[model samples]
Target: MLWDWGYALEILPVLGQAAIITIEATLLGFAMAAVLGLVFAILRMLGPAVAWPVSMLIELVRSTPLLIQIFFLYFVLPKFGVTLDAFTAGVLALGLHYATYCAEVYRAGLENIPRGQWEASIALNLSLYTTFKDIILPQAIPPVVPPLGNYLVALFKETPLLSAIAVLELMQTAKILGSETFRYVEPITLVGALFLAMSLVSAALIRQVERALGRRFVR
Candidate 1:
């Protein structure tokens, strides 16, 4: 097999295209996680009567492998006549799986808020929703920014698992290119480099966010 560097260069555009899909999936999935995770976190905080099962569910999902969850959605859902396209399945699976971790992240964030804040909200007789909307979240979110960014980075890497369900992400595209050219080394190398580039770029952006949010938070 000829190790043609130019062949890898030619496929750069194709890899870029697939990277976009991976980024879209990561962003959308993390957005889903942020919202749903907050809900679960709030549910857990309110009381065990409502919270216990929610906590159990979150822990259960967290304990199990995300890959298994993806496989279950792709394979088992069909048995019940619920069919999903590969992209949708990949997005939903990734979203649901990561939501568990995000819930814990949010929960930790909420807990970090001082008891005085909660007490003050109660003293002000603010409704729970009002208290959270006006006070708790505004304060909690900034400190969590760094960790949340880390999760985003983690989610970016996990996109390759989508390939198991046939979503054509970066690694998947590399696999196809490799098979076609019978040159796994070049294609796979390019994929790894692409992933590393993305991760480094994301981390840098997150650091900027951390600094900006940190200043506002301290004010």
Candidate 2:
């Protein structure tokens, strides 16, 4: 038969396990990206003294292919005695690769705050940390939620790339199923459907957050 219901049913449990790994990697990698990106943005905004090196680091990561980064992390780093397992290496690559993009998003958000806000903070003799934490990030982060949400979805999709390093994500599970059964349709289609469903759910959640933030921003 072209597609076997029995095979599909048998594979569901396997695929479900893989999906959990995918979700875990996505959430962890995105958390790293979010935090690291904020740090990068803050350092760049500190002054030209720090900005130039940070800017170059961001550019280097942005210019490289994520696959290369993954391979380097998984394969090459062990040569230097900095070894990581497949999942950790893949997650780190995803986090660091997307961090450059997240940094730009943060930079734009921080820049969007009016110059007057900075001047007022300085005039008040506020500490730099207080100005950023109390005055800056609150205003900057709200407007950037949609963009960051987009990145979250993007990073989730990118999890499949982890399979290159033997992470056994959804797509990898599907591929293994296909190889074992000598049939591709059921496993591949199931993987695609699961991805679509998750993407839609993420987009909906993002919209809800955006609306909530919009209300709060206006208030």
Candidate 3:
């Protein structure tokens, strides 16, 4: 009676559909974070004139709570004629928040590259684009893959926060089901189990990526 198998089964499909939204938001947000973070890292390397403002921006984002950022993007920005729907606002908030962390990771990775390598690239008369794309990123990215993957998992967990904006991700869907059926036990339990399973799977995939990158870089 406490756990209704019939009801759990009934709501499974709906939760699964919502899970797709969660996954989509996680992947899209992470992709944006990864790319934007790289740009931030590179820009910081450009010069003091550029790095000062970029550093300030990164610190500001890192200092704020993600929920506040989500609310600002979803609610406040509309007042400035920058309206975004729930999902878009949520994804942008997730990306921008995490991108600060990702930028730090990238900066560490880029700094680890040898000064000799930079000298060699310059000696070879390589363009900045070629130096970064062909030489720098290939070497820098491999060492940082594990940390970036950790951020991927962290970002996935953060998707639940998107529910605050009524994005209908997995947690939001589960909450809705609980309210409609007045059966919180089944839906809430299922959501917890789903999160655990997904986190474990993501960890495994991260390990695989780490190993693959290690092998490639070793060669």
Candidate 4:
């Protein structure tokens, strides 16, 4: 059969559970990536001494394949007296891998802030923290939200990689179902639909946020 609604319906609950896992990993990993990326960007902007090291680290991460990073975190870390469960390892690997991209996005946004703003902050005797918190980040972060949202969607799709370490996410569930029943159509199609639906929803939400930020900053 080209399609089987009954099997699709029957397998949905399992996939639903797996979908929750995928969502969890995406959210936690994206949060880590966002924060870590911001830190990386800030360090790079601090001075040449800090920038050089952080720049090289970001380059190293960006130069490497994410699958290798994931494998290293899951399979290799344990030998060094550091061990993580599949879910934790997956989250860390995803976060660290994408952080390089997020760092560049953040750097672009930061660089877009006018030099006059920095000089004005200094003239007003604003502390470095105050300058960044009150003036710079507020201006920088909003413009970058759309790109970060794109990363969120990309990270959601990347959750399939978690299955490599047995995190039991959506794609893994589909693979198991296909293997057991020897019918790939229903399970695979449903998984694809789920991903599509979630991606569209995420994009819509991102657009909404962008509009809200535009209105707020425009005021």
In order of listing, the candidates' clash counts read: 0, 0, 0, 0
Can you write out model 4's per-residue Cα lDDT over 49-87, one digit (the tens) per residue? 999999998888899888889999999999998999999
Pitting candidate 2 against candidate 3, the one with the higher TM-score is 3
The lDDT leader among the candidates is 3
The residue pairs found clashing in candidate 3 are: none
> By TM-score, is 2 or 4 better?
2
Give candidates' CA RMSD values in order: 1.4, 0.8, 0.7, 1.0
Candidate scoring better on TM-score of 1 and 3: 3
Residue-level lDDT of model 3, residues 1-219, one tens digit each, is 699899999999999999999999999999999999999999999999999999999999999899999999999999999999999999999999999999999999999999999999999999999999999999999999999999999999999999999999999999999899799999999999999999999999999989998998997
lDDT of 1 by residue, 1-219 (tens): 456778878998998999999999999988988788888988988877999899888888888998898888888999999998888888888888888888888988999999999999999999999999999999888888888888889988999999988899988898998889787888788889889998999999999999999888786
Q: Estimate each model's TM-score.
A: 0.95, 0.98, 0.99, 0.97
Q: Where is model 1 more than 4 Å wrong at Cα?
A: none
Query: What TM value does model 2 have?
Result: 0.98
Candidates 1 and 4 compared by lDDT, better number: 4
lDDT of 2 by residue, 149-203 (tens): 9999999998988989889999999998899878999999999999999999999
State in Å the error of residue 134, model 2: 0.5
Runs in model 3 lying further than 4 Å from the true structure: none
